[model samples]
Target: MLAALILLSVGIIEIQAGGTPICPTITTPDWGEVSCSNENNVGSRCNLSCQAYFDLVGTTGDAIETSCGFDGMWSTATEFECVPIKCFPEQVSPENGEVICSANNFAQSVCVFFCKEHFDMVGLSAANNAHAICKDDGDGDEIGQWVSSDGSTDFQHPFPPQCQPIRCPTTMEAPLNGQVICSNRDYSGSYCVLFCRDGFKFANRKEKIVFSSCSKEDGHDSVGEWSMPDAPSCRQCTRAEEVQLVALIHESEGDRGQYQVATSMIAKVLTILRRRHGINPTLRVNRYSSSVDASNEVFTTAFTLKSSKREIDAIPYPGKGANTTTALRYMDQRLTGDRSAKIAFIFTNELRDFDAEMEMKARNLVEREVSLFVFTLPQKNRARTWIREQLVKITRDDTRVYALPRMRFTNKYKDEVAAKINDITMTKGCDFLI
Candidate 1:
């Protein structure tokens, strides 16, 4: 019976190993095994083993036992993952440094001192522990200085030095009204003593004039003193005691003629003379009438009597026989032996042959007693050579023959002509000849 029991036991065991059995097979729990009691027999137990867990082993070939306890504690199976140590700032610019932590939980420093072109490392050397600073190369003093929070250095100064302001001399002073002291730059001052020229008088000499310094504030120098108070007087007009004279202007032609151009020119001359020399003179105009039998003779006699003081006449169209003869004879009789009277004769329009005769006769009649002045109109057909020669001869000796250009009739030219005549007559002493 014992032998049979043994055999039965062996079979039962093999069936259990085959994973199926009528009765539970009991065995000791090994690695990767789960222990559980059989359901059919309360006292019978079984061991459940997984191949994957049983294959794991330690370095000594011992099984790696793992257990899940009711307390919820798990046995260590693999090591905790060893993450790499890192730094807050992963990288830094050259000439700068960084701090890092090691896998062993240790801190370390790293400095990059070398910089790129156009930059220089300042401060201390960049090593494992020391901080590093850098700057740009520059020319001015105080170079390599930080300019902004962004780690930039100034290459130049903000402001540069400049030249000083110029100083004006203090020795200069202002001059009086008629006189002024001119500075080096031609600035005048009232404090400067002044003197007037022979004809000039002091207009204002009371207040002292002061000139400000030459600077950007003051633009330029002032013109010096003058003779007049408001305006400096450089010259004054001097009146002469002389006899008044008359000028006859003829506007139309007749038995007694009209001299329009001559009259207009003479009026301008008189105006200039009055302004320049303070002289007042008389002027008259008479028209000719054929009804008057002796019109030529009457006009001649009237002109002579009127112009006796000045002995000047303006004869229009002297070529006309009656006018030429009448004027010559009247001038001869009235101007003769009158050394004080100055005669000025103006021939208007175009000159004729008889003009020469009249000129010669007048010259012979008055001699040095008369000063003749002729105004010839600009014309294409000028006087004959004989008449021109005689006129020139008379003008050279005692007359002024101004041959007005064609342009003299215009307003602009009239002013110029009047100015020229006034200048000549006033500057060059002349008898009161109208």
Candidate 2:
């Protein structure tokens, strides 16, 4: 026990003399040497010296000596890194190419090359290796440099890598009121499409490609060429030339049963005119019953009827034959100074009165160049014949009278109705003509 106590006391005294933990392990760096005064314990001093072509960094006290302190730390910063001397070759780049590098010297440092606009790199496996790295000579005695080619022995390859300009198919400028967007500005296989601004519509391409492509050449062609259909024009109609359509919807009690049909027909006509053709026309709806008189304008600049119910609800149906002649007179007054062709679509189930005065009014319509078309849903076969006769008497044209069959409001019937209206409007309306 006395001997053990003596040994422990000696150890304590040795630790107190140092008063710090054991110094960290030290070793000579590659291409360099280290010298020590007292070794790795506390109060030990270490100094670094590099071989011929290397330089030391992070050193102190004449930039070399570093001593372990009582706090178990080096007097200078740890990791006294030694770096190789820098050597740069005549920096060169390929024609039309630029170079970038992380470092100008030392092994593992790399230089990258890139081609200018309209050009692409060639001769190397770009998918795998597109840059050059600094490496050492086989004997580790000579400094190496980045070169253009793997087999080159010079500092840089005598002939640099090539960059070839890319050529694409030719393209025309964008059309009026339209924009063209391309995948590649002028390159083979580039694609482009046309877009027109609001209020203008692309015309004449009902069943043809509107987008263009820089297509690969056929065997007959010398080079790849642009492939495109005849481009369509963005079409817009002038305000004065717009067609004027006035639908005089009959709201007499007798025609109330056909309200759904009339509503559907009017809505479909307006939709085709405004939505499909982009024609904004003045629309005056004459909802007349001799008892309750209402003239509701459904559309002037825009059409707002979304459904058949909305339109029917907007028409007040509490009158008796407010007189089709009266409605025509109203439209005639509206068309006083306007020289544009007008269409007066009259929707009715029966005609209350057909007199000499009505005939004169009808003749006035023809004189004013106002086209009249009559769409009727008569009650009986005899009544249908009479209504047709009356339409001919009023408009003086048998073709202008269309006696609709008594049927439910089905899609097939609606489609047939829409087709009939479309045919008439396209053929008769001046704005629909080319």
Candidate 3:
């Protein structure tokens, strides 16, 4: 072999007298593609690859290549044909729900969805049309995909059915003079619990509570609804008792309009107490001022509840001064009694001090069991929010305090304000939702 050696390139081998395979032309499968390098002749290997979501028939891998044999034949059992991929038996189903398919998630299979108790199929509107189809993935990938049948294509990602907890219609809420509670107020299978404040009971004296529950019955859209007999209302059972209310109007330079509203609402309260609740409520309206003379006279008493409204002139005075300190001291000395409900309504626009003496005077009011309701301006004035904070500390119970724009004290919100005062008489406070 060394006698006639010709070195054409590095690592070249000597010529031998053996013949290589010359295979025929190879064809590509309908589901795949085939590619060959170096003319597809002697010892050439051809590649076989499937389309998207498709696999080769009777093959364990897609990366393998087809070879040519010495008999001029392509590789055996290496068919380049690809078939559609198979999909789910369980992975495609929704949690707390199920899906039954006609063809078991194979190509051309149809799936119908269902939900377990206390659950709902959220993806579909009605069970009649709750179905999906398994076919070629539309995105150029011939793989199987679940397609919605409701004509709505938008889904979380690839569009599959889903299940969620059923919710009840929002028709009932907390009742007046009582409270309504539930394990889950917004869902089905939730039981409602009702409770009335002291001295109150349901209209049906025999039954303390009505049977109320969220059910999966014939609710609007088959979602869920409250049971037939809704939660009953509560009524005042105990007789109305006497209440002595003292209104302290803290008049300032520009608080005339606010002064007028305070007196007006107080008048409305007197009328409501006498006419509606049959309570012989006594009221005394007084103004607190810081004038030198006011300290001696100590803010002259304006008016007191009378057998007739004509007996007292309910006039709005143009007073000047906001000495709550002086007023509190005077009230501490004046408000002496063992009356059950001694209410003090203080209408002020500002707080003069946060000193210990001032706080002690306010604490005296609370220690004497005086229910103090303080009304002031809204918090639009960032500088004056301290007034509400200071008053809250004095009242001890912030619910007894009310703050709004002075002009809002009109009859438009009479029932609302009156109901709050009414609850005070009950001694149980207001419900969660007024």
| Model 3, span 272-349: residue lDDT tens | 665665555455556665622322222222333452333223443436656677767655555555534566777776
For each candidate, the alpha-carbon lDDT, in order, equals: 0.34, 0.58, 0.61
Q: What is the C-alpha RMSD of each candidate to the true structure, in Å?
A: 28.8, 19.0, 13.4
Better of 1 and 2 by TM-score: 2
List model 2 lDDT by residue over 1-434, tens digit each. 01111134324212333244445556677776777788766889987766654556544222377898765556765465566745356345778788766665666566777766555566533323456666544333334545444534452322335665544445644657777788886565567787665434566543212677665432312234566634567665233354566776664365445766666666666676556655555665656544224345554546666643375556666565447678777667665434454667777776767678878898898777677777775353344323457778777777767665454433334445344444444433323323
Clashing pairs in 2: 289-319, 289-320, 290-320
Q: What is the TM-score of each candidate against the true structure?
A: 0.30, 0.38, 0.39
Sort by TM-score, top down from the best: 3, 2, 1
Candidate 1: residue 40 lDDT (0-100): 22
Model 2 weakest 10-residue run by lDDT? 1-10
Off by over 4 Å in 3: 1-197, 200-241, 291-320, 333-336, 377-386, 428-434
Q: For model 3, what is the error of residue 242's alpha carbon versus the real structure, in angstroms, after optimal superposition?
A: 2.8
Model 1, range 1-434, lDDT digits (tens) per residue?
01111135334222223333333222333334344453322233333332331222223232233333222222333221111122233324433222222221111323232333222233332112223222222221112222222232332321111112223434343222244454433222223334444333333332223223332232221123222223233332122233123232212234222244455455555555557545443333222221112222212222222353233333332233224334444444433333233344444443344465666765664454444554554444444223555555544443355554343453434455444444443322222212
Best of the two (2, 3) by TM-score: 3
When summed lDDT is taken over every stretch of 10 residues in candidate 1, the lowest stretch is 157-166
Q: Give the least accurate 10-residue stretch of model 3, judged by summed lDDT.
A: 291-300
